[model samples]
Target: MPLNCGIVGLPNVGKSTIFNALTSAKAQAANYPFCTIDPNTGIVTVPDERLSKISALIVPKSLVPTTMEFIDIAGLVEGASKGEGLGNQFLGHIRATDAICHVVRCFDDPEVVHVAGAINPLHDIDIINTELLLADLETVEKRSQRVEKLARNTQDAKIKTEASAVAKLKATLEAGKPARAADLTDDERTASRELFLITAKPQLYVANVDEAGLANGNAYTEAVEKRAAEENSQVVRICGALEAEIAQLDPPERTEFLESVGLHEPGLDRLIHSAYRLLDLITYFTAGVQEVRAWTIRRGTKAPGAAGVIHSDFERGFIKADCYACEDLFKYGSEQAVKEKGLLRSEGKDYTVKDGDILFFKFNV
Candidate 1:
């Protein structure tokens, strides 16, 4: 399954607007709280210039780009963890995603109402973070109740280790820190995945600014950037209203509109790529006469693991991969040129796939 990033923020923070623009899907972008109660999911193609570049060289019949899922989760209110304003339902939706895109309202328009009666990006971030932390604290506390007994009464080493990990997580949450903030060992981190704490997922902040703010970030965006810097998180600034308008245009018109706005590319493209990188995702390609296709995998995926992304049978019967860096192809201008320079490699099962590798997996079922 493709990994997903959940769009979340307080009500009327342009989460739906950004989602609609990102996917070109008509999610209800009304001017009120909880406009989107149910999550709206859209599959977005990860844009890669290399796909077309490789296609140009291979002259393939078809070109397919890999896709990632984006889910527009309902706006989270202040007391969402306590079942306020469908908060429980929304939190569940967020917990299911691989990553989070926290959209913060950085633009001011008196015409549109703010849920908190004013715009304060830092305050808004704190409210959402507190709720998520509280929700995770509750989860850990409840799990501890059962595990504590097992650890103390039984001689099972696994249960004792889990109990200790749970205790560490609880302490961190109680201290108003996210679950990801806790220092965990590799084994504990792997085990904590089963807990599925919402705060443990990677996150990026989206600053929804006005047209003017897009060029030079406003005070609100500056505040967001400061907070993100302190947390070591990434912040992406975009004009939600303008992106919505751009999303409605045709291809030619969109190009013209972007040029008119003095932007080389739509901000949504930058936002998408930022979110993709936030998840530690990398793209590899399979170049063939039949097709030139892009594929998504984690950064350090081995040959068999990368093959498993294409097909389970391929991984089960994996041999080796005939691979060449896309850069070599671009530099040498042809497969024959790359071969002559010995840039192509036959990789074994233990080979870790690189981002722009053009691979042809050799397998026997």
Candidate 2:
């Protein structure tokens, strides 16, 4: 996985608008479909409510949220597989992403043109998914041809394994199933994982709705829900225009705005947190008066690998770590109290980190 998601949808589906709101950077948003010719990449901070609480308790020089990468891909169109309307170029960008956030335009706007000439969520999804299937089919078929030669040769074990994996993947793709749907042995999966095929990653549909849709997600959301149920995918309904406005407000005003809208938090926060969990990412904190920062790591990250994210030296000379869960601090009110309560623990390199752990690393260098 690339540790990032790519935003994709048909032209004028508010992909760029959402991307700009995510990064708070201008990425050339225009009214027309395919206005964004090139992909715009952004690093967005993953918002955590716990970070604010932690900051309140232990004041730091700065509070930095863990970040994730988002790429705004050019809009994909029907007949894209046949190279219609810059489809081929756009598809290649999506293939490089770890996950896909398909932004379906569920809002009705006479001023903004719909690329498909109507506002049909299922039809739009099919157009994009069909193109992806076609692209993956091309890949599987091409790779299968070369692997067929090696599958018959008994001399090379590596080649034989690869050939088998490719054959399985080819069959899965031919059945209109994604590469991720293919069943492979542990070694085969490990070998094939590096291919970074687009269809192999999970997907979530983002219903870009209007104001009325945001409040209760009108008929458009219902359509998306039905489609998601069929595909076993999830839907996140948000108003892109509203989120963009919220992103511009100051902290205090932002909160006020959310309350006014009867929302507890910005929809972007929910979307980001959902993406974090979808990617199986967790945060562990390193806190001190000097700096208290959140670091992102895979869910099962062991001590050394988590430390390595800070610096190579931390892993290279790792001795042990002094750790206590943040929940312990919240309960005990202070580190000294945590120690007095016997909640603090000294862990060795083998310790697998738990979410909300506050760690202080010890090293030789």
Q: Which candidate is the best by lDDT?
A: 1
TM-score of 1: 0.98
Cα RMSD of all models vs. native, in order, equals 0.9, 1.8
- RMSD (CA, Å), candidate 1 to true, equals 0.9
lDDT of 1 by residue, 1-365 (tens): 89999999999999999899989999998899988999999999887889999999999989999999999999899899999999999999999999999999999899889999999999999999999999999999999999998899998877877888898999999989899899887777876888999999999999999999998899999999999998889999999999999999998999999999889888989988998999999999998899999999999999999998999998999999999999999999999999999989999999999999999999999
In Å, residue 52's CA in model 1 sits off its true spot by 0.7
What range of 10 consecutive residues in model 2 has the weakest lDDT sum? 189-198
TM-score of each: 0.98, 0.95
Q: Rate the local accuracy (lDDT) of all candidates.
A: 0.93, 0.86
Query: What tens digits encode model 2's per-residue C-alpha lDDT throughout 1-365?
Result: 22798999899999998999988989988988778878899998888777777777788888877899989998998888788988889888898888899899999999998877899988898888888888887877787788788678666877787888888888888888778779988788776776667778888889999988897888878999888888777788889999999989999999999999899988887778777787788999998877788899989999998999999999999999999999888887878899999988999989999999999999997
